[model samples]
Target: MVNAFFLFILAGLAEIGGGYLVWLWLREARPLWYGILGGIILVLYGIIPTLQKFPNFGRTYAAYGGIFIFLAVIWGWGIDKKIPDTYDWIGVAVCMVGVSIMLWAPRH
Candidate 1:
């Protein structure tokens, strides 16, 4: 559903953006505030998934893992200026298919 996908995207951005800020603080020598903000956002990332309607924690997180991978690739391409090759696209495609199957497939 639209809401589920939106939540997944929101959580993914929070995780990646928070981590990127921490990376900038430690690795790129940004200010301490960067790390502080990143930590806060990371906390938000942790809580966002709990908002999902899915009752199974493992299944929700597993499906989220695939979404995370897809978002990371896009983040790298756009923010890091790293263009993805054919292999990257292929891998993302595979992960997305796996995510769809895991999240939406019928159950007994």
Candidate 2:
């Protein structure tokens, strides 16, 4: 459980870094290498922690899908300096809540 949480944190950071790289690439074609490299690094970095933490790859990936959606919105607004409108906020909130349930709900 502890490992899982730690990896999740790392995954979040990796995603944020990856998103920033993509954003940069969009602005400056010259930085395409950085974006490509950063994406590969971020994905590889994230994979180790995820596999080490979760027994099932499917579950880990499923959780990531939700987390990524939420974080992507934050990355777009916070890092990219683009303000999200009301609908965007609402969608993020809804998805995050669902993610919370998916990750935390006890199965008996």
Candidate 3:
């Protein structure tokens, strides 16, 4: 459980951080190196989930969506200087509950 969450965190950071770098290079016009590094990190983001013990690809990625959303909110708050409003917190809570159900539900 803890290991799974840790992996999720790593994946989220890689994906979001990489995307941000690409966005900076393209939209913000930072530099080409930003995009290059971002692309590499994005590749890492894709590969990180495969290291998980979970065998179900569908379930693993599905649960990761929830973690991604939660992490995105934090990333926006910290990196983008966007404070999450009440609605954002509510949505994050819903995502967390959904993730818990999807990942931790007992098999039939």
Candidate 4:
């Protein structure tokens, strides 16, 4: 369970960080290397989730969507120095609640 959450965090970082890099390159006029590296990281992001022990692709991805949202807020706050307002925290909380229901709820 710990490992699963760790994987989610790593995968989120790869995707968001990679996208941020590409955003910088194209939108902010950074050098080409940023885009190249971002693309590579995006490719790697495609592969990381497969390492999860969970076998259900849809469930895994659905749960990951929630984790990704939470991580994105943290990433923005730390990297961009943009503090999250009340709505951001509430949204993150809602996302995690949805994730818990999807990933950890008891089922017959």
Candidate 5:
């Protein structure tokens, strides 16, 4: 459970960091060093924890990827001034349902 919490936090931070880079890159920004640094930091944060601790890499990743997509949509609408339409909401719902199944399905 603790690991799951950390994973989600890392995922959100990564999304925010990558989103900042996208915003900067779109503005014809200078000093591109920040982009590389931020990207590496985000990727490392998201990858290291799970790679180091998770027992089932594929299942962990599949579940987190779905949750990441859902959260990205929320962040996009809330912080990026992008309004999500019905299709976006539907996609998020579907992904979240899949995430729940992936994470909770019992193995016998």
Candidate 6:
């Protein structure tokens, strides 16, 4: 569903962005405020998944792992100025298929 995908993307961005900020603070020496804001956003990332309609926590987080990979690739490409190679695209495709199957496949 649209809502589910949106939530996944939102949560992924929160996690990635938050972590990136913290990375900048500690690794790249950006600022202390960067780490503080990143910590707040990380808290939000933890809460966002609870908004999903899926009842199974494991399934939801498992599927989210795939989404997170996809988003991380995009983030790296766009923000880090790292162009993805063919192997990266292949990996993203595989992860996306796995995510779709896990999220949409029928159950007894």
TM per candidate: 0.99, 0.70, 0.98, 0.96, 0.75, 0.98
lDDT of 1 by residue, 1-108 (tens): 898999999999999999999999999999999999999999999999999999999999999999999999999999999999999999999999999999989999
lDDT of the candidates, in the order given: 0.97, 0.72, 0.97, 0.95, 0.73, 0.97
lDDT by residue (tens digit), candidate 2, 1-108: 666656665687686787567767877664678789778867766675555545667767677676677777777788778888999888878876876776778877
Name the lDDT value of residue 70 in candidate 3: 96
Query: Candidate 4: lDDT of 56?
Result: 91
Clashing pairs in 5: none
The digit string of per-residue lDDT tens for model 5 on 1-108 reads: 667756765776676767577567657584677677767767765665564355787877777777778778877888788999999999989988997787777878
Give one clash count per candidate, in the order shown.
Answer: 0, 0, 0, 0, 0, 0
Model 2 bad stretches (over 4 Å): 1-6, 46-52
Which of the two, 1 or 5, has more TM-score?
1
Relative to the true structure, candidate 4 reaches a TM of 0.96
What clash pairs does model 3 have?
A: none
> Residue 70's C-alpha lDDT in candidate 4?
95
Candidate 6's residue-wise lDDT over 28-97, tens digit each?
9898999999999999999999999999999999999999999999999999999999999999999999
lDDT of 3 by residue, 77-100 (tens): 999999999999999999999999
The global Cα lDDT (0 to 1) of model 3 is 0.97
